[model samples]
Target: MSADALTFDCIVVGSGHAGSCAALAARDSGCERVLIVEKSPPEWVGGNGYFTAGAHRTVHGGLQDLLPIVKNVTPEIAANIDLAPYTADEFTRDVMRLGDGRSHPDVVKALVDGSRDAVQWLAERVHVPFIFSFNRQAYLVNGRQVFWGGLALSVEGGGKGMIAADRAALAAAGVETWFSTAAIELVIDGDRVVGLQVSREGESITLRSRAVILACGGFEASKDLRAQYLGPDWQRAKVRGTPYNTGDGLALAQRIGARLTGDFAGCHSTCWDANAPDDRGDRVLSNQFTKSGYPLGLMLNAKGERFVDEGEDFRNYTYAKFGREIMSQPGGFAFQVWDSTTIPWLRKEEYADDVVERIWGDTIEELAAKLVEKGLEDKDAFVQTIRKYNEAVRAFQAERPEAEWDPAVKDGVSTQSSHLQLSLPKSNWALPVEQSPFLAVKVTCGITFTFGGLAIDPDTAGVLSDATGKPIPGLFCTGELVGGLFYRNYPGGSGLTGGTVFGRKAGREAAKLSGAAR
Candidate 1:
């Protein structure tokens, strides 16, 4: 290595939540110099972490126990909200159940066990303020705020704020960061990775490093990769975050005999606004570009047919997978239908911007007619579907005798029909859409980060060699690059937690490897 050329004790690729955290951990782990290389320009430094709400789904003993972490919560406010204890076992069950027990147990355990600590560690280093997520993760129950779905705290400024806080932490730790610089290849020295080839503004250079941590994201933004792994139709799906996440790290690692893990086709997706630009929407819009209110309403395809069961489970539990289902529907599009009765409780997305495409009407017939004018294939089919659903809702209410609308819990306010039974019945939070004026929002699939990535040594967060069946010395990874933690689905808010959990582990171990290399 040239004496004047840049070098680091540990070099981290990507400046997302995982990469930033890894840099901080490397410094804390006694590494003399840690450098973070971000492919994105300085403006878009945080990857998907900047696009998220920054809500963390972690285990906690409830509001009382979280008082220390969320110091802003007053005692008076605490009495109204019920923050139930989400134990480690519950975290494990959520992960296994969501993944259908397909997620690697070791990876899940590492995430669950280190979750709380991860939040605390980030908090101490970054000076970020965390608070209860009032809008989505909790509901007002019997005049008390009852938190459910195992999601509790969030960074005060959401993802944007959290990213800023992480950047602050990086600067404070004296870590070097390179924005708009991309790592082209991993410089493998025989059996160990010893340096990295990077390019910036058409200039190329190689930087030597004792150890490397790859925290750049997956292939969600690559249309070709999406078609290759997630199917052809996925290429049209709107990207929920940075377009820079085109599987650069994954592609580089694969060249070095890394074994990829999890479902390459499976990704975290949601109901994005149909009118949203093809690329990731601006960071200023942030979490507002998508609609998460489908649970409180119904979704219909171009045929105006109810495709997936809108009330199958809590929105967060099923929203990601359901986006893929929508993409599979005819025209690769769907519309969300709701009425005044459901509008009050829906997650806020209706008021996003003038670009929102929705048809509003005072009556079902009018709504159907308006939808037809907006290019719906079959208005008659929509009318029949609505009538059948409304009839089922009444039947369910009469059958239960004491059914009431409760958002805090899966209130079992469902629908059933004998005359016109739905192939996919609504399971919970089902209310008749009889109230007016009715509304329908056009929606399509918006994919977030992908699940496929390099296999890892769960304990050390070191990338394991597919051929050797052991960790590749001097190589570690975290965030979306570290796979085997998820399969079919993932727990909401667990992405940040997973990054923190493994990022710390990778950083510590990489620092140790740097020492050994010396």
Candidate 2:
């Protein structure tokens, strides 16, 4: 290769949330030339960030504490916004509790400490609107303040509009973007990364750089990797987002001796269709049944028996209900049955007409017949189960006021009802499968992202090699590529929070390295 083949101050791989932030931060920090290499086209900008519900949380005092230290936010604006402050201790406790003590303390601390600034930086600098409320769930500001609607807008333009805004900012900053270019490997010179070998339009080229950032995302969409790392159960589950994430970056990094951490793979189980086609051609509505607190009139496994507390944590419940726990039974999965009353509620409140349509029946027998027609269940058995459940619901309602009856009668944390008035009629039970046209849909767990990835230092955002227990020089990894930070469980909106905070850190640090080289 010629000496002038290609060169840049910094090279960032991938154009997801992390890579976008990294590129922007580097340029803003005065790096003269930064290049972003993306295997996919620009139409795929923001990666999963475009599909997110955009809530951000931090463990530190809200925007107030961060405004003074962060360059992006002004004291006047910070003071004007209603700020919610959460102590580091409380944040730590919540994270640890949610993670089941498996997450790295340092990573959690870095995310929590830097979160306020990250949120402010994106809002103030990128022109992304940040609200305090949306759809009833409060935004956990600074890990303390429960603000409404303070999340990035879904690409559909739900609210927080940072995904598009950030992309625009990166372009305005003159960050060179090479789409349809895949980074095949890290160009290593001794222990340091020199740059990347890229393939674009069938041409292989080498790009030289002083610093490199890996933000290529995780392996949730790769069936082979999911089966290998996440176990057989994952192989059979449905996937929620983009199907292109095959863990190419993670595999490449490992080949170069990067250590992996967190679990082999962790997934959210709730709101997934247990038997929805793996091709994901069918639109599965999760918000309706999972987030809207809908009642499960009857939950039956393949053998037609109730197996779990329907109202438990939707993510966890889905996993347990779909995995070997329920699949090992006579039926490979479970079917959720509800009535006409439930369908309208799901449609009006949950915006889940898709789900309602899939399972709707005008009569209990018709619904059971439909499932049989779809090859989703045994017609006779499903009908019998509905009859039994209806009898039980009627008995329960006869004894107690409709308002007093809980759909998730057995529950540790009862999410049985969000709109309490809706649960008052015993007939409102996702029960009485008697309401002629019953609804039944075979459901399975669907995963959003895999948690396992390269281990990194929270302070530097540097990818650490297992052999040396130290960061690999010139190589910084962020987003889903870096793991052991989230533990096995997620803390509400922490996924996006970590990505933004660490992406900024990596970009800034990479810029500093580039400056030194010059």
| Candidate topping TM-score | 1
Q: Once superposed on the true structure, which residue ranges of model 2 sit more than 4 Å away at CA?
A: 1-5, 59-90, 136-161, 273-299, 314-334, 340-356, 362-365, 376-442, 516-518
- Number of clashes found in candidate 2: 28
Candidate 2, poorest ten consecutive residues by summed lDDT: 151-160
Clash totals in order: 1, 28
Deviating ranges (above 4 Å) for candidate 1: 1-5, 349-355, 417-421, 516-518
| 222-287: candidate 2 lDDT, tens digit per residue | 788888987876676665554556797787788789998886657544445544446332222323
Please give the CA lDDT of all the candidate structures.
0.85, 0.63
What TM-score does prediction 2 earn?
0.77
- Native-vs-model 1 lDDT? 0.85
TM-score per candidate, chains pooled: 0.97, 0.77
Estimate, for each residue in 308-424, the C-alpha lDDT of model 1 and write its tens digit: 888877877887788888899888888898899877776554443354766789998899888776658998899899898988888877777787878778887777644445567
